[model samples]
Target chain A: MNRKKENGLSSEKVFNFCNCAFLLVLVVIVAYPLYYVLIASISDPYEVYAGKTFILPSKVTFEGYARVFREESIARGYLNSIYYTVLGTLVSVALIITTAYSVSKKTLPFKKTIMVFYVITMYFGGGLIPTYLVVSRTGLLNSVWSLILPGGVAVYNVIVARTYFENSIPEELYEAAAIDGSSNLGTFFKIALPLAKPILAVMVIFTMVAYWNDWFTALIYMGEKSKYPLQLALRQILIQSQATATMMGNMDGGYAEANKITELIKFASIVVGAVPMLIAYPFVQRYFEKGFMAGAVKG
Target chain B: MKKGKQGNTNAAVPKESLWKQVVKHWEFYVLLLPGILVTIIYKYIPIYGIQIAFRDYNAVDGFFGSAWVGLKWFQRFFGNYNSVRMIRNTILLSLYSILWTFPIPIILALLINQIRQKRFQRVSQTILYAPHFISVMILCGMLRIFLSPYGGLINILGEALGFIREPVNLIDSASAFRTIYIASSIWQDAGWGTIIYISTLSSVDASLHEAAKVDGANAIQRIMHIDIPELIPVIVIQLIMSFGNLMNVGFEKAYLLQTSLNKETSEIIATYVYEQGMLKAMYSFSTAVSLFNTVVNIILLVAVNKICSKLSDVSFV
Candidate 1:
């Protein structure tokens, strides 16, 4: 019996060791690329290309970052992205919260119909062409409102919020409020909204990340370069390489030198574009997991 | 006499009329108004315009005035050589992605749940989920840099390890496109996907594990008997949800990753629609193609949901 127990303990130790080792490998696989990007961004482009900056950066310079800031279009795109993310998050959270609160009520008239109306869109959309036509015809083309309004209400978020309200908030609270002669709106504003802080944070962060990362809407609606968001601007620099030539036109460098600097600039811009989201990630991660728990519990 | 009878009933119980109930809940309706309006305008209006797919759409004639051409655009789309390729590519990519990525988070979650040290587990999770926050554009940008023929990271490493004598242009390789796409997708989402499973696992009774241990079940045996059974419902639900979105592959990443050389493998339905509809302005044809895609998705979703319900007694709809 003692020998059997010893064998079990040894097997358990082996299992734990293997599990930790596998997870350690996974962490490295997940993290190494971002680390490489950071080190590459700071290292000399020549050394980067020569594979000298793999483990550590060499000939570190701030020239790439300086040039990224100096680029007029990237600067404009950054401002535009910030504006859109803030405004868009506010609009989305407001719409989702209000709609979710009303729908969560058992007494709301035509609740099922209202829910079905929203849910049908999730299964079927009118394809891209029709949506584009509607946007263009509505005089929203080339306007910031086009980006903000067209896809503002995410039905999934509304459903999640609605589920939270249904499960987390007690019917007794509403009953008590009603006993005190609180109207539906008053109860919603006073009781529901105040109690919804956790879900509200989740919605805000989700919407903010979505808007900040969005490039497709702007690509479709806005034609002007000045109005481009950071993602779109990055697309031009990194993917299409259209802006790199123009960006290099002002700098006093030959063909080889300019090519090298352009590579560095691409790396630097990636770091810049990602830094904001990464900075917010820890806080966002905590709330997001909580939100997911809330969602998964009853979903 | 009828009025007197109604008044007597009303006095017995203060029953409000439907109209009265609606009026009493006017504030609720008011709260619902913006959402309703946004839905009608954004979602319903586009659905209304879907009729143009049936018509010979011309911007000058407007949606109503366009000539009806039943199945002509559908015929045109099917008649094109690229249609089969696009559909095949879309299905294959999605299937491959689901095959590879679906099982990973479950395994990760199971392993994570076994970690004795809470701090190590949390830190590992944080690092894993970090990639999810990176934008698709930046991801593609990094891919280009890492896969470039001239002194790319992969090439440099390949040479150092003596795996390849010459640098290969992986980003432009038709064969490598799907692999790269799926790999990047797994990297981005596998960690984030663990949240649901981990949350589910957290709710599992610790007493069950202790009981299994007392029964001389080893760690793996305990995990198999106690943990996996607990995770089955969540896993099945997640699987069903994924199957629901089986046809809706990530268009953004595909479009961003496509080069002229790799377009052979990368031209999926969503990107095809965007190109034909917006870029080429073959609006009617493209809309028909997209409508076909959506119909296939709905059918797939329903069919999978039915199968899952029958097999597992756990389904999502």
Candidate 2:
């Protein structure tokens, strides 16, 4: 028995060591691209292309960042993205919370029917063209409302929030409030909303990330280039290579020089576009994990 | 006696009419109105507009005034030369992605659970989850940069490691499109996907592990017996969900990653719809195509849910 126990202990040690090593490798695989982008953004563009700055940035420079800031459309896109993300998140969270709270109530008339109304949307939709046509016919085309209002209430988030309210907030608290002559709205505002901070944070983060990353909505709806969100703007630079030429047109350089600088600007733009969420991620990670657990457990 | 009588009267009273109940809880209804209106306008209205799939829709004639063409657009889509290719590409891409990406997070979650050090696990998980926040545009951007022929990372490394004599343009290659797409998806979401499984595994009872350990089961044996079984239900649900969404491969990444050269493999149904509808302005034809896609998606979802429930007695619907 002693020898078997010893063997088990050794095997466990080996397992733990192997697990840690593999996990470390995974962390590096996941993290290195972002790290490389950061370094490549600051490093000399030619050197980055040459792959010489793998470990540490060589010939560090801010020319790429300077060009990124100098570009007019990118600046505009940044402001537009911020506006959309904030407005969209607020609208989404409010709509989701209110609807979810209403649906969570046992006394709400046609509660099951209302829930089916939302849940049916999860399984089916009219697809993209019809949705686009609706947005256009509604005169939301090329408007900020087009971005904010149409995809405002994500039904999945609504269900998650409803589940949170149903499970986490005890029924007795609302009953006590009712006994105190608190109105339903009053109970929700004064009691449920206060208790729902964690889920609220989760919803806010989820919506914000979604809105921030969204480019397709802008791509389809916004006819004007000036109103394009940051992702769309980045797409022009990175994918289409349209804005890159315009941004580099005035530079006094040959094709090679322009190419290098273009590559650098692409790297810088990615960093600029992605940095906000990445920075906010650590703070929101705890709440997101909690939300994930809550959703998964009940799902 | 009075309280008992009051309670009995409340119980004896007929349930309030729907309208009266709604009026009594008017505030909840008021709160619900915005969502309902939004859903009706944005969701249902579009669904209502799906009749245009049967109509020869034009901006001037409008949805209703347009001429009805029964199965005309659908027939056209099926008759189109690229229809077979688009359908094949869509299915193959989704299938290959599911095959490659599905098992990764389960393995990741299992491995993550085995790590004894809490801090190490937390930090590593944070790192792993970070890529999910990167936008698809930026992801495609990175893919372009990393796969470029002119001193791209892959080529540079390949040449240095003596794997290739020349730089290869992966982003522009049709054959590499699916591989790149699947690989990048795994890179981006595999970590985030682990969240659900990790959370599920966290709830696994400690006593199960202890009992197995006491029974002289090694770590692998304990994991096989305890962890895998606990994960099976979640896994089945996830698999069903994945299969349900099999037709709905994301348009943004595929479209963004697509070059003229790679369109042969990258042109899935979603992108095809966008190209035909929004870009080309073939509204009726595109709507018909999209309607078909949605129908297939629903059928797949229902079929998968049914099959999984019947086979394993575990399902999501």
Candidate that would win on DockQ? 2
Superposition error at B226 for model 2 (Å): 0.4
In candidate 2, stretches whose alpha carbon ends up further than 4 angstroms from where it belongs are A244-246, A297-299, B1-14, B314-317
TM-score of each candidate?
Answer: 0.96, 0.96
Query: What 10-residue stretch in candidate 2 chain B is worst by lDDT?
Result: B1-10
Question: Which residue pairs in candidate 2 have backbone atoms (N, alpha carbon, C) closer than 3 angstroms, thus clashing?
Answer: none
lDDT of 2 at B1: 48
Task: Compute DockQ for each candidate against the true complex.
Answer: 0.69, 0.74
Whole-model lDDT, candidate 1?
0.89
| DockQ of candidate model 1 | 0.69
